[model samples]
Target: VFFHNALPFVGFGFLDNAIMIAAGTQIELSIGVVLGISTMAAAALGNLVSDLAGLGLAGYVEALASRLGLSIPDLTPKQADMWQTRLSAHLGKAIGVTIGCILGMFPLLFFGDEEEKLEEKN
Candidate 1:
């Protein structure tokens, strides 16, 4: 059950971070320069885009998670409401999202801080 609860959140965190990073980097490089916005502002806009994408893609993420062969345990309503069960689910989601966010940072390696380069050139 813990694994079950965690699985979808992993996908959510991964996509959220990955999209935010990639989109933010691009926006910072392109639109930010043209509009003279700060990097943080670009990042905020990128987060907005990522959040919108998350809303649209949530169902797909859930479907992918379901395909991973992890299923929720068959529990009675009372069993499902137990404190231990709820705790496990929460802990699972926390750990899973942490792991997935770390994994999603791979895009940073490729992005390589274009801002640093611009600063150095100036």
Candidate 2:
């Protein structure tokens, strides 16, 4: 869950790096667009990798518990539904990171440092 939540921040960092490089190079508009798209793609791929890693870790823990003969309580239907809801919420966050990265690349679209600092304070 922590990994899922952190993916977007990681994506944002990558986007920042891409922007910095683009600014330094004074790339043409066309190249800037291309770089933005590539950066977004990379961010999405990174998020997907993080999600897969989380799933794998969860599976490993489940397997370990089973091997240890631990009696895990069976979740009721409602509980199962709730768990799925929470998982989906995290999944949405990962998706949001992908979308946000793409959007943030545009001028006036990215959040400034002041905005981020305010968010952090909150």
Q: What's the number of clashes in each of the models?
A: 0, 0
TM-score on alpha carbons, each prediction: 0.94, 0.25
Predicted structure 1: lDDT: 0.89
Candidate 1 per-residue lDDT, tens place, 1-122, comes to 88997888888889999999999989988898889989899999999999999999889988998888877799999999999999999999999889888888889988776768967865
- After superposing candidate 2 on the true structure, give the runs of residues whose Cα lies further than 4 Å from its correct spot: 1-81, 107-122
* Local distance difference test values of all predictions, in order: 0.89, 0.49
Supply candidate 2's per-residue lDDT for 106. Answer: 62
Model 1 residue 106 CA deviation (Å) reads 0.6
